[model samples]
Target chain A: TQLLEQSPQFLSIQEGENLTVYCNSSSVFSSLQWYRQEPGEGPVLLVTVVTGGEVKKLKRLTFQFGDARKDSSLHITAAQTGDTGLYLCAVPASGGSYIPTFGRGTSLIVHP
Target chain B: DAGITQSPRHKVTETGTPVTLRCHQTENHRYMYWYRQDPGHGLRLIHYSYGVKDTDKGEVSDGYSVSRSKTEDFLLTLESATSSQTSVYFCAISARDRVRNEQFFGPGTRLTVL
Candidate 1:
């Protein structure tokens, strides 16, 4: 089983603050993804990083995949109240496996 | 919205009682999944179906069972509810793309076992 560990399980900040969340693993993945979830709703995908050392940006959010493919990160610049939510990192299982390994999630609270 | 939905958005049942949850999708997606979300546990896959009448176990499949009799419906059943099973359940649909794979989720179902 692949284990994914996320840091700063809980975070709180005021508006205009920039924050970064990290996801690390001992196992390598072919692809890594980041997702944000609101309460009472299922998680929605933010970005998918397929290659190592790849970066993708969505508006004010930036995502990076580690060169080892065992880690990933999400950085929010000038975060707003709407940025408050749980962030997750996932890796799809390898070798004909379709199940994605999920992180416990980082609960972020951005106050206006 | 992915046209995915879960029935009985909220349910409360006692221990040793059988409970079934339904997942319906209109997208005709080839893959359907069942997951449970708990604080500090994120989402754990319980079961998934790759095609009609074909299903497989996930990381946390104990005490739970799933069936996919058709292309659009997947069902999850708890033989006898347990307090450990109290958590928010989510159903997701994904259509395998040649380029990349993405999953679309439903609102979710909150089940509390007493």
Candidate 2:
């Protein structure tokens, strides 16, 4: 089974502060996705990076895939109270199985 | 949104009782999956169905079973509930094949076993 580990399991920051969450894996992935889940709800997809060294931006959120396809990172700039949630990283298993393996997740709280 | 729904939003059951959680979809997606989320374990796959009546066990499928009789509904059954089985369960569906499709998840069901 492929394992993805997320660092800084919990984070709390004041509004307007910046934060970064990391997801690392030993196995290579064909595609990687980031999701944000609010309390009492399932996760919602934030971004999907399919190529190595790929970077995608959505408003204040920036997502980056590793050059080796074995890691990814999410950065939030000028965080707001609405940015508080659980962030998760997922990758589809290699070798023709599209089953996804998920990281434990980083819970971020942006306080105003 | 993937147009997924899970029934029995919250359930409290005794050990050794049978429990079933229903996941219904309106998108007619071809792939469906069942997963359990725990505090330290994150989300673990219990089972997944690639098509109607075609299902496969996931990493943690010991006492759990699943059935997909129609394209819109996937059922997950716990033959004998245990305290350890208590957790939040989520159901997800993908429109394209598992190889290249994004999965849409349901709101989730919270189960407490005593």
Candidate 3:
């Protein structure tokens, strides 16, 4: 099974601080996706990185895919309480499967 | 947001009872998926359908079954509910776009089995 390991399982930061989360895997993926899920709701797609060493930014959030396609990172700048949620990284399963294998996820709490 | 909706947003049932969760989509995307989210496990795929009547199992498909008879609906049924089955269920849809494996997700359904 393809597994994605996420580091810093839990994160707590004060508003205006900056933090980064990492997702690493031993297997190569064609594409990688990042999602943020709030309590009592489903996850919302934040970004999709298809090429190695690709970077995408959404407001205060920056996402990067590794050059080996085996890892990714998410960086949040000037975090706010609204940024508190569970962040996940997922990769499509290999061989004719579109289903993705998800990381354990990082729970972020931004205190004001 | 994906034009997906899951019925029975919250449900509580006894063990051994049958439970079914419905996922409806308006986008008519060719791919539909069912996943469960728990405290430690972020999201695990239970089943997915590529097209009408064409479905496949995921890593954790032990006690769950899915059916997709039409383009807009997918149903997931728990043969016999167990306490371990309790979790938040999400339905997602994706298109054939190569660059974007990004799936649109529904609001989700919460289930608790006693």
Candidate 4:
């Protein structure tokens, strides 16, 4: 199991504040994926980064993959109440078994 | 939003009893998986299937069994429900081989064992 460690288990910030969440792992990954999950619902895929030093943006959110492909980060610009939710980073198992292993997750709460 | 549905969105059962959770999908995807969500545990895989009647265990497969008699329906069964087994269960599917595809998850089912 490739264990991904996500930092800042919990975060609370006022609206309009900027924040960044980090996911780090000692194991190398071929690809990494980010997801956001609201309470009482399943997680929704935010983005997938496959290349080292890659950056993908989804409007107010930016995702970056480490040049070593062992870490990733998510930055949210001008956070809003709608941005509040649990964020998770995942990577598939090695040896061609694409079963994902997820991090514990970071719970973000944006206060309006 | 994945055209997936899990039955008994909420269920309460007692220990030492059998409980089954159902996952149904309309997309006709080839892969299906069952996972459990717990605090500080993220989502742990319980089992997965590659095709009809083909299944395999996952990281947290103890005390749990799954069956997929049809392509669109996957069933998870607990031979003996326990308080430790109480948690939110999610079903996910990948249209292609999981190695090259993204998984779509169902809403989830919350189960309580007393």
> Please, what are the lDDT tens digits per residue for candidate 2 over residues B4-109?
9999999999999999999999998888999999888888999999899999999999999999999999999999999999999999987644444677899999
Q: DockQ scores for all the models shown? A: 0.54, 0.58, 0.65, 0.56
Q: Tens-digit lDDT track for model 4 on B7-97?
A: 9899999999999999999999988999999997889999999889989999999999999999999999999999999999999988744
Pairs clashing in candidate 2?
none
Q: Write the per-residue lDDT of candidate 4 for residues A4-40, one digit (tens) a residue.
A: 9998999999999999999999998888889899989
Model 3: chain B TM-score relative to the native chain B: 0.97
TM-score of each predicted structure versus truth = 0.93, 0.95, 0.95, 0.95
Count of backbone clashes, every candidate in sequence: 0, 0, 0, 0
True contacts kept of 1: 0.49
RMSD of each: 1.6, 1.4, 1.3, 1.5
Clashing pairs in 3: none
Name the DockQ score for candidate 3. 0.65
**Model 2 chain B: lowest-lDDT 10 consecutive positions:** B94-103
DockQ of 2: 0.58
Candidate 1, residue B65: how far the Cα is off, in Å: 1.3
- Taking the tens digit of each residue's C-alpha lDDT, what string does model 1 give over A6-41? 988999999999999999999987788788998778
